[model samples]
Target: MLTGALSSRMSSSVSSSDRIFPPSSFGSFESPGIRASSCFSGPNADMNEYDETDLFSISWNQDYGCFAAGTSHGFHIYNCEPFKEIFRRELKNGGFKFVEMLFRCNILALVGAAANSSYPPNKVLIWDDHQSRSIAEFTFRSEVHGVKLRRDGIVIVLKHKIYVYNFMDLKLLHQIETLANPRGLCCLSHHSNTFVLACPGLHKGQVRVEHFGLNVTKLINAHDSQIACFMLTMDGLLLATASVKGTLIRIFNTMDGSRLQEVRRGVNRAEINSIALSPNVQWLAASSDKGTVHIFSLKVRVSGLDSITHPNSPQGPALFHQNSSTSIDPLVSPNTGANPNSLLSFMRGILRKYFSSEWSFAQLHLPGNTQFIVAFGSLNSVMIVGMDGSFYKCSFDPVHGGEMVQQEYVRFLR
Candidate 1:
């Protein structure tokens, strides 16, 4: 590792019993609007604010093969495919508020919880699990909002600024200024051939896209309200964003700021917990506080866009405009999970976009009043991780889009 430490230390390992219970049924429900910051828990809350059984944080690895959960004790890692606990560190002196794994490797970016005196929140600790100690550390004047990791670089997110560094020598490469981002919202492309980074821009509802391969930066005004959550495809070519309004989810082309498609989650405002795109980019899954997970079919394809224009063309990005008349078909209704259309086709233009916008093709309903994040799993199934310590794997129908069948359920934490 970076510290050149090869010696290992003995640490306590906690064993967890995995219980496989019968699949449980779910139903949908809706409530009032939730503030965009509810999921982030604001800047003041700490590990002491939660009960001993409650999780301080939960996040998936870069490829979603596994996830890390931080608790009052320490942090635990779980495998997604076999649904087993890989390993855990029960540190008696400290707890982690953020434990980000680097694609199932031994290296992790850790930010300690407020109650952890040994490791403070303002410091980023690069822990090498093989050594059972921190190899490299970065201390800042202010609390860190988040951290992103890649094979070649490390990104540190602060309230108003983001710092990028090379992984080999830990050399500072670039820094960016952003709005008041308490959540430390940032995403990076996982593909090794290209480098793309997305984060909040300097203005409200704007997203800054840095395409390192193309040597270009594009700013997209994604929404009118504040951005709630967004996700970039593994290739970093497509970006899906949701606003605080939570009514519409828009997809954008990272090469040039252009809206590719717009899908409606609901007419009412809600807090979106997470969004996921299939590996093929043909399906998208989103979860909100309304206790529902919606999946939408994507019409755009990568090959189709590449045929339109060269990536370096000076004219404009070769893609279909979101509002282009040719992009819409009035004759056929949209493929969605919502009720059948009631309005006449001629009256669509007179009504709000909600009346004519595309909706999810399939849905999986869970209980409301809890936070959840979704990811596409193998064999047309979706894996959902909730803050309530619930984990589920449900399968959806690709041909007949409707309600999903719950395949397996487990409580990862006791």
Candidate 2:
């Protein structure tokens, strides 16, 4: 009834394309759809982005939320969150050539070979974070194999003999004769003022545990080959020992000195160079001559010990007992086995589970084919030192199903 111009203007203007695909229809198509590939992808897609270089050693400073690294040139300090370098210092003392750094209670201890000398005199330098200069320096006759800071800040040097000193005063406290040349020393924090020494002798390795002046336990012929490294948990509940022949890593009960589990890696013989224990006492890590690091979880099993005290229980403390009159094997003698409530049975269960699983190794390229030292610090960080003037800092993520699957895939490919 209306005129053509008036009716056309009154109707809504619309294009042919709009009529074919209306706004309502386009809205339905705009809804996002899930892709199968995106749904199934793993979380490690970005892991390969970071270049893994020849890391010399890595240590974490819990107080500062940072970690320190010692390399061939000098030391690098990095923030832990994003792993960014905050500071780097070039060593005027010929770099960290064949050296190792130990961080204890905000004190940085540097142990390494001196410059220009083929047989570098083992040197220990301690630096406090608050102060710019080194606070203490101790020289050793032999190359320092290992260094440990005790609870009271006493620095223990494991050379041919064990030397204890008040780090603050640089005063010598005790010197104990060792059964073998000590390769490793660890302070047992939980066991009433005790420490354990790992000595790898020409014949066999030995583990000696002492509390103050009293020797609590000693294991002779502990390892078939030379004992290369050892570690004790913070609580002194578990002890891990590795031999020169890296095939076997034995975990023991610190209380009664009984084997809990024996973890082995590789079918052929490999030399275990260093070892470290996790902060939670949940994991034990070992590095071998083959340039591989192996980690294992602790699965403890506890059963009551047999409630019978052996005849040897009455033999006035096993450490001081005179064996001249007794024709008994000290290890098998009743006196040595008299801890009815020692909880050795429960420890053995934990070891059994640890050894049952086949371990997977993570290969690392070190600076040289040098013997490397390893230590577990705050957080999930590990520091390693190669003989050839290189230090590496390695960080680990907790194992998950995806990681296990990936590890298996890599193993199968090899």
Best model number under TM-score: 1
TM-score of each: 0.79, 0.56
Residue 64 of model 2 has an lDDT of: 25
User: Which residue ranges in model 1 land beyond 4 Å of their true spot?
Assistant: 1-51, 304-348
CA lDDT, every model vs. true structure: 0.73, 0.46
